[model samples]
Target: MYSVARPCEVRWVNLSQVVGLSTLRSFLRMESHMSRCFAAILLVTTLVAVEVPAVPALPDAQVYAVGVIPDLRGMLQHTSQALGAAGKTLPPGMLEMGLGGMLGDPGLTKLGNGPILVAAGPGLLVPSWGAILPYADAEAVIAAVSGAGLLAEAAPGGVAIGSAPDGPGLAKRMLPALDAVRAGMPADSDLRVVVGLDRLSQAYLPMAIAAMQGAASAPGLPAEAAGQRKLMLGMVAMLRTFAAQAGALRCDLTVSASGWKIDAVQALRPGVLADAIRPQAPSTDRPAERLGAGDGPAVVQMHGCMPPRIYEAMATLLQETRRDPAAAALIDESMVAMVRDCAGALTGSFAMRQGFAGSPMRQLGVAMVRDQAKAKALLDGARNLFSMGVLADLMRGMGVEMVFEPAVRHAAGLPVDRISYRIDPAKLPPGQDAAMQAAMMPTQEMALAPTMWVWGSPSAEIDAALAGPRGAPRLAAEALGAGWDLYADLDMALQMKMQFALMAKQIPMFAGAFAEVPCGHPMRMAAALGEGRYRLVIEVPVEQVADFRNGFAGMQRGRHQPAEEPETPAAPVF
Candidate 1:
């Protein structure tokens, strides 16, 4: 989170009302019948006790099934055929969309008359529903999607788990939320509101890659052709499944006088959320034998199994993914000469420090001794037999996409988005305050601004330190390690969110309001984020106060209405 030097008092004055309401609502909801009426009286008294300011409701939203179709090309082709003669004249770029593709064909205006799914015009397709990561481009996407008012407006893009607290009893928080909007709803509202979630299998990625590999190695198929047909189909399946899950998925939304006020049950899409919860992967994949014999999930407790061989393999795999301008030239160099000059040094230079053992080294060595002979063998039986087709098939079974998009959205029984925080200022570890101070410190002299944001891509880097190595009972262990009876990162996000919620009180501006300007310079963005190991923080700019109010108001009411002003006839001026 970024820090700014704003008056703490200024922030507080803006937040009193929200805290008052939350506190009041908490105190008034009594379970026993005898105190029910008394609870109501307390509610009114509580409301009367503090400043009752109207704060805009933030967009606590999760639109379940916004499907993205795979292969925008397919979409384009379908769209093109629909557009008679103009299809032939279409520029290739017309088919490649960034945010939303701009099809030169006027007929393709509306995104298919069907459902919601995530797909790409090309290969950067996101799975059905998940989270969009990294803040720059991610922030832009979130701003646009939320701005379009899918379900709700956003309080800065912080990670949060919107689930009821777990224990031997009811989570005390939900009671207040239920009470806050329940009375304003109808009896049938229960049916309208439902909680729904979708999670992708962990194998989604590996299998996707396998499919692409299979296609690429197919007999008589061009590279693009193979990718276009086989891999594209797999992507479609992913989108279809994601959307299908979302379409059928039910989320508990409170039917409000405004619209659906969703109380999202926050969890994470499989790969991501589970990563923080489960044991972390060893930095280096060792031999299976290294892990030795142990119990629990498939992850190795034995330790020796995933020796440096896996890391060695991965380093070569990394090289395969790299495309240097000089690759073809280097490949054309006489194999023997190249090896003497290049082979020995390159392996030594790479990270991971592994010697030539993976495919690249093996291939390079083969090229050196008998270049044409090795080439003939690769082209003849050896390569064709366990062909690239074999690998593609493997990836298909694994659900891996050949083209990688760093971040995409998905739904996995958890929240694609979330918020958390710490309220009891004293509960913070001694050094934490210093960390928070550093995070909150402003990057520049725009110190006049009240908000500070560690405003770049917000993400969670889970280490085994949080979730003990493989099946260590993460949450409990983390709590113990942290010297607390209990603790969770999401819980921390929640606490911070609550603090913001509190600030949103007297400072109506704070309610679901946040602005994070990525460092004063984009180059410094990474440096800024790395400065504090911040969970989440968003500062509200006082100058743009009106826009914030209007945005929040729209969320609370489900739509924004232009403020009204008295009208005077223009006839007087005439």
Candidate 2:
């Protein structure tokens, strides 16, 4: 539905090849009589000559995206050259021969861009010119489709029908609406399409919202749950606004073997988006401050944020919930107490920086200011909660130990304003020794090795208690197990090479294409909101346009393949 830039060329090429191969195989399987063979060959040739035409041109408003793909043959040539410059040879495969034959031999290249027009209607109408179906017989194909109930009438140019009419047909309806919308723009567009959100909203949004409202009013629902209905209504309102704005939306895509990019813009009208979302002046109540000193791979800092109105809204919700007797009864007392005790931890602004320098260290610094006295009290409460029988058992099983590293006093330092929690799996309780040892034992799928070991109490009292002549072993089994287990046996370099090999094997075009794309390929997205307009754009770099044919082959094969099960992530220790 959304007209974003995508890889389509290689797919179509591969599809045509698959169709050709299957037809050839069928011909070979028939009775080897000369008469039958001749007749079948003629039939197949006739069908091949009547290649499907490109999509028909529609009115400008009906089209969502217009793009041109650089000739794949040319792009592949460029890729081969680039790879040569990088001193890398492309993998040998059948895809290379397919690309060289279809696009042109990289050795004997031709240069030209192929245009693809996408119009919105009963289905996507793709008007391609001098692209895939270069030898198509337009008139005969159109006549065939009209006779086969695939089309009512053929539009101008080498266009094909996507499907039979489901209703009065999008073309018929869009033509009538053209005059009405013409006042705002031109009489016609270079490309015709009509599936814009504005058109859809005008045709169905009101009815959809009404139906949702009806569903929400089902019997036996409690009156106090009106919040749910209110939330749905709010979402509907936003959707309506977005649909209205989309009337003036326009998108354009430019695809190349080296890179692909798209630009889209939507006109905004006043009083459309909610007032709460309107840009507000910087909050003066919160003073500006840096999040932290940076030594980590990622850094995020937000300051002079959180407008007053947002807090007012939260307060209003809290008051309403407290007033509702049923809602108040469901609120947990411990949770409420926790919130009250920890509220001082959020002193307008806070900074948290986490990194691994030999070992992972997480530092959280809060601006408690006048509420500094409450930091210790909040931390002590947290320690008590985490140290409980139920919580300690769970934490120990997961090989995690939480310690409240009490705030250290310095010469004229604001230590009270900040509190820190240190996680040291090595300091787990003695009772968990056997469990830790068992967890570290190698499994069938993976192996673990200990790298660092620690023994003796981290605190003086415990160390003194075991200060006899012999004492315990220098490295405690539990700490050694936890530390050693952290050193996982993974060959990242070998894994990456294996993954590249697999992708290339599955998709032939990948050999030439993968050479041009840097690992993780660059992707960029941007958006902007203004007084009366909003716009968003996304860009992706594509390499070796000819390689897309493999994608098409995959799709054709997918039709007969069993659906694969979706992969799920491992369960969290918690």
Candidate 3:
């Protein structure tokens, strides 16, 4: 019995061991299969990670921009140095500190500089906009943004901040557009903004048309409402044409120590407007050449040629006006003919300058004449028209009594037939009549020269023009040399001073405002037209920026001040 039990036990143990070994072998096979699957997944994820871009693609938008600053600290330093070279005074490292404070993160200087991507699209009420900013340390940027009370999210190689909550998703969508814009960006460009005019017009034009049509068709409109409606419709049609023909509007900005400069271009697609703007033969007669070099700096100056389309529009409006009884009575067919003739006589080029020298105010205008005889005839017709009883009554109705007369003057051995306007003191406000009369004694004077039409406030301005150039004007040479279609140089300080002085004479509260306001530097603008595009360049000086800041501060102070009681006039004598 013992031998039989031992043999049975041994057999049971051997069977159990064999079963256990079989189970262990099955488990090992299963583990090996799972390991193979894990390795395949690892390979796929590694490939995807390598393929993704550092910056996410930008989503479709109506507007997109990229601002590249390879070295933020270096740019700030260079700007500061340029400002110093341009004679602008600032405390050491003030610009950097100011920018850092504005962002609420001084450590921003440590971030790796990279291209910034921005995008915007139409929204229900406003526009939706977002930006993706590059960063070396995503954690630090996220922390800084959160500390500054802004929304932040981690991106592929940077941080995303935007108006929406899902900034990371937005960054991913913008990646493609960001890549495209970066590839096309000019090497020297610091900032470029692109506007999809077609998309914008599509989104906004319907609302605009509906609103305008509603207004135009409203009941109880004026007698001239029909003509006004036509004009409005015409404008809308033009805007539609512009949108259909224009690709995009691109504006580039470059900031340096000298000043801030912006260049905006609108490229036109093949269309009627493009054909109209095609380049023509250059004209030898430039209007800026006619302007006389003043003794001192000019308060304001402008030179440009009116496009043919403007004249056509004017003619159309005049025709519309003639159809209305009330309008026709005010602007008769004969008057329209005279205006047309005057416009026809002009070569389209014109220049104007206003200064405060040789008189309280010196103003001059020069228009190149295509037909001197026609211009002279129109001048006579204008004088007669102004002297007519109808025009006299019209002026009287507006509290202005104008006396028009013809006078002959000689300047630089040239006879000038001048038509001058004298204001009637009786029509002016009491106690201010004499001052007003003094301010506007030689209100207007016009003369038809052999090659040009000259006009000015006082006779002295005409004399200066007839005497020829005293010295080179400030911006005339530069504008003409560059063949700019439009140019303007305005001394904001002088203009404001003149305006304030005039206003103070009538309004006592404005007496010391001019003195308190800081002086601004001259602001210059230059524009040119190409075959299928338009270019505009603007330069805003640092002094002008300071002036604007100070002006706003003054306005804020005035807003908080207590209101003063309105002065009661003395009882009128019986």
User: Using TM-score as the measure, which candidate wins?
Assistant: 3
> For candidate 1, what is the TM-score?
0.17
Off by more than 4 A, model 1: 7-101, 105-427, 430-548, 551-574
Report the alpha-carbon TM-score of model 3 versus the true structure: 0.63
For residues 1-574, could you state the per-residue lDDT of candidate 1 as single tens digits? Answer: 2222232322222122232222222321211111111111100000111111111121122222222222333445543333323113445435435434211223333333321121111112432222211122333344444454322111222211111111101111122232332233333323222222332223244455566445434565422233234333433333333332221122222222222222222232333112322111222221111111222111101111111222233233223322332222212222212213221211110000001111111000001112333322322221222123332232222221122121132222211221111122242322222233212211110000011000111221111111122322222112112211111111122223333443332233344432221111000000000111101111112212323333344334421222223222222110
Which sections of candidate 2 miss by over 4 Å? 1-117, 121-137, 143-152, 166-195, 198-248, 268-296, 299-522, 541-574
Per-candidate TM-score against the hidden true structure: 0.17, 0.34, 0.63
Best-to-worst TM-score order: 3, 2, 1
TM-score of 2: 0.34
C-alpha positional error of residue 516 in candidate 3 after TM-score superposition, expressed in Å: 9.3
Candidate models: Cα lDDT each: 0.23, 0.31, 0.53
Better of 1 and 2 by lDDT: 2
- Compared with the true structure, what per-residue lDDT tens digits does model 2 show for residues 1-574? 1111122322222222222223222322221111010111100000111111122223554433222222344435445544433344465433346543432233222222332222243232332111121113445544544565555333322232434343223333333334333222212122222234555566567788677666445555443224333333433443444455444454444433334444444543333232222333322222112222333321112121222233333333333444434334322233234335433433322122222122122222112122434544444444444444223333333343333333332112222111122223333322223222222211101000121000111122112222222221111111212211101111222223223333333333333332332232223333333333333444443422222333334444433443333222132121
The best candidate in terms of lDDT: 3
